[model samples]
Target: MRKQLLGLAAVAALLTACGDTCDENKMVSGGFDNFPAPSASADGPTPGSAADFQKNVQDTVHFGFDRHDLTAEAKTALENQAEWLKKWGGVNLLIEGHCDERGTVEYNLALGEKRAHAAKHFLMSQGIDTSRLETVSYGKERPIDAGHTEEAHAKNRRDVSVVR
Candidate 1:
């Protein structure tokens, strides 16, 4: 009986020693959107593989309606791209500019060219070689998102950096 009691005490002590360390752990329960948010990272993943480049470095920088100027957010993304280019020196990129379906072909094509130039100039300012970069204006010919909604239009107005 004494041995059994001592074993019970030891078991209790062991359990107490393994007390909960998850006091700060939390689980959020809510209605989730169908689309998951992009995972935020400090420096993002390394820029060696194609998958890593797509995941970590943002390939596209969005612009406002009928605008070729880069936003602060676009600048930040381009800075990251510049860093990636410097890290992976062998990469030659094509900056493809696109636009929404609202404008005429000629106007949209001009806007797209301006957008591509804007992105290329920014990358060049960040020390990326102009020789390593090429620009193409898809205008409204190609779009990643096809919906006729504002969100889709926003996505359409972008300069995509493609590995060549």
Candidate 2:
């Protein structure tokens, strides 16, 4: 298992070298569409195998319509992520709040901020240091799926985390 994980990490590193953001910790997806959101990749201690390391970290979790409450599923996801974070100390992360393309821009921005803060609070409750987290809101300015459909709107509502 270790060997296989190492091989995957090697592959990820090679892929990242091709034109991705390579942080000292791990390879972060460079020039990604949603740059502020929890990138689709992890940036953390590589732990001898990138795959093993990234497997511990996860992409950001999405929210529901006009709601900032972290769903039960989201709670589980954050708990898992917190576990991964505890594995690597002396780290900082950014929480980017987001929202769907509904409501006024200003209102959405406030909503997004609340969502991001909520995630940060949850992570804190899980034992992550508050000093390690910062919250920002993008509102509806950034969207992972940009169609005028419910599916796209749903995907846009999210709280993403980035290791710094």
Candidate 3:
């Protein structure tokens, strides 16, 4: 009986030693810190309202490598954007198309234009007015991520909708 009690004590001590007090350098965040914050609309509501819009509405869409086609994800995001556009009828939107750092300047610019057009078309199809939507190609000139990694490249291939 004494041996049994001593074994239980040893087991309890081992469990206690392996408790929450163990130190670890585990990752605890989603890594959104590397991405830039959504830009606020100019001539629209104040920061409070803009923050609400950014938090509630979709403001960006990502694309595949060397492709301007809208994926289902892009369509979903654009659908949300359309709703926001409908709610704020008078606001103009600037769709800034971007590309990864692989293509030549001219090619990237053209590709970016296609990406912007693709997003614009989707928004228009969802009932957004053509007049309220404008597009500009930033190409690889304004990459959201500067690293040479694939993840960074993926992030760079995107269209950002800035309210005007």
Which candidate tops lDDT? 1
Stronger candidate by lDDT (2 vs 3): 3
- By TM-score, the better pick of 2 and 3 is 3
| lDDT winner between candidates 1 and 2 | 1
- Ordering by lDDT: 1, 3, 2
lDDT of each: 0.89, 0.82, 0.88
Ten residues in a row with the worst lDDT in model 3?
A: 40-49
Candidate 1 has its poorest 10 consecutive residues by lDDT at 34-43
What digit string (tens of lDDT, one per residue) describes model 3 on residues 1-164? 99999999999998899689755565355787744456544444344345555777788899999999999999999999898888878777899999999979999999999999999999999999899999999999999999999999999999998887
Backbone clash total for model 3 is: 0
How does each model score on TM-score? 0.70, 0.68, 0.70
| Model 2 C-alpha lDDT per residue in residues 1-164, reported as the tens digit of each score | 99999999999888878774646566455775635343233564345233443556665798999899999988988887788778877666788999988899999999999999999999999999999889999999999998989999989999887766
After superposition, candidate 1 runs with Cα above 4 Å error: 1-47
**lDDT, model 1, position 115:** 100
lDDT of 1 at 159: 97
TM-score of 3: 0.70
lDDT of 1 by residue, 87-161 (tens): 989988899999998889999999999999999999999999999999999999998899999999998999999
